[model samples]
Target: MTAPFRPLPFLSEARAEQAAGPRLRALRQAAQRAREAFTSEGAATALATCDLVSFPYPTVFAFSGAARSPAPYVMVRHRMQVVRFQQEGTERVLLFNPSDYERGHEAPFFKALREKYGTFVTTQVMTRRHGTVQAHLEALGLTPEDVDYLAFDHLKAQDIRRWLGGDGQPAYFPRARLLVQRAEWDAVRCPHPLERVWYVPEGTGGVPPERVELLSGDTWLGQGVALLSTPGHSPGNMSLAVATADEVFVMSENGVATESYTPLQSAIPGVRTFAEQMGWEVVLNGNTRENSLEQYSSMIVEKVFAGRARADGGFVNVHPSSLLTRAVMAPGLAPTITLPPPMSGAFTPVAAPRHAA
Candidate 1:
């Protein structure tokens, strides 16, 4: 059963760190200086209670499954991200495909890929230097227990058991509950031929039934937060949409980066013209041809979500969150990757779940 949401007193960065041990407290000293870089963007009301924490997890993969295409493969930048959603002083942690953080948790997805793909994925993608979410939260003086909710856009390549321990095993965050789509959970246990390589065996085997929250369709999580079923990459794939005062933001692998989302606007030479000539609709995030059609449709849903970033007509573009890549589609076409706009006081609350465009 899901526990009732409880609002905690907002902790100042300093006060939050006070409870941390000497070793853990030292993490804050550096973050204390880094905190100066976080801005509330003065007077601007945010669309949601959203915060973005990113680290490097580079990967070399194709932008889509389009064969005989220009810019077939490239390196990804800022691939790992931890998004926090807060409402009425209560907060939830939404990990965007959280896996492969050097020394954190290791998933079968990483191990299999390394064995098949070799050094690039092994040395650069899986072992990229990046701070783990545990480390980042500790810097903010928070532990997993402080988290109320955990979710992902989908379950592909996710090894979640370790994160939600049971059967006498200790979970990373004891009090937190996991939110997963029913379809996603089902697929994990019995994956399609294409995605089998991504699932961790018995990833959910040890998770207590009470620790899981299952969803069937698009649902609002809070005032300005939602999880949308944007299946394409996988049967149960989903995406997260958050509205803040400045603009709404989404975290997903639907389109690895900005260029994948808007191919026409892509800076990758010949991509725009080639896509136009080939009559290609959308690009799949993965290279597999299986479920290619769904992947294509999923990007459309993602495009709509990104467009909600601003009401006055701004479009949403992912910042390659956690993945830092030198490859830009084009200097003129690359969108500036950034977190949602900052908040001064109250966030721009969504009255209810709006229709997906």
Candidate 2:
């Protein structure tokens, strides 16, 4: 029998937020102890990121909690993170948010949004491809087969057919199994009227059931890696936490930029004022409002777990999977502080398993 994913103790904070007093404090203290133990286990062998696409994103959604902005849109860069680590003494690879930029139009929301408001609102800024997932993997000395698992922070605007061999097609990552939250998987397949716009119609259709791994809650993957269940941006929303030689980095769409995690320190025009007035520590990526409070709590979990940047203690090391980037197309919406892509160690091919003679 296979061992199950170890649960992180910090998750109790998700439920503790309702009262949010002494009980919450007790839960947090225990959670911090768990975090310390988890971090002490050591870091992953290697981690790297690849830029996939850059496009205009609504200022309203990017800074939902602090929505007063002159700019309607902010240019954002969506990236794929590849992490290699040892599990049971064997090298394993995890690909987080490996979005296929070319097929992004398949999502009903983007397709109709582009068709109706393309000229006035977005125009050519809807989608911009930087490189293919295959190319990036090759450049890093990795092949599709080397990837053991594939996961996304959430399933919004994603079409997994190409990667998982759906609808009578061959898979791009032959050996990869999708690690998704069961709630997210269910929501994507049959979204609520409000949630429909963000998902591709029939996106998960024909995906081989055997290739999908449904996770129930926060999961510890191995030395230095865990998936934090961060619902609210979307039901079953999750964030990837990875420990490196320098520090741990949490990746999620729950927030757009570093400022999202540290709103009090933000220099963006309206971010600081809104956060101060609302008494908010973190600004949410509020595409969905169903679980805003829970999402707020989850971002807290990510911030606490990621801790502060080693070089500059001002910002927490919470990296958005689709990080906000400066674009000529979207003016007046530049991130006050930008972090260079996080990297650690080196990427090398996974050794083939030995066969007994």
How would you encode candidate 1's per-residue C-alpha lDDT over 13-80 as one tens digit per residue? 32234433442333334322321222122111222222222322222244443323343234444343
The sequence of per-residue lDDT tens digits that candidate 2 reaches over residues 1-357 is: 126357776565445555645544554565556568778988999999899988777788898847555677787889999999776666789999999766765677667767777644543546677888999999999988788888999998898999999999999988888999999999998899999988988778899999998998888888888888878899989999899877888888999999899998887778899999899888998878877867887788778888898757889888899888877656656788887787888997778862111
lDDT for 256 (candidate 2): 93
In model 1, how large is the Cα lDDT of residue 127?
42
Lowest summed lDDT over 10 consecutive residues: which window, candidate 1? 35-44
Candidate 1, residue 64: the lDDT equals 41
Tell me the spans in candidate 1 whose CA falls farther than 4 Å from its real position.
1-61, 65-73, 78-93, 100-109, 116-121, 124-126, 308-315, 318-324, 327-357
State the lDDT at 309 in candidate 2: 84
Candidate with top lDDT is 2
C-alpha lDDT values of all predictions: 0.50, 0.81
Alpha carbon lDDT of residue 98, candidate 1? 51
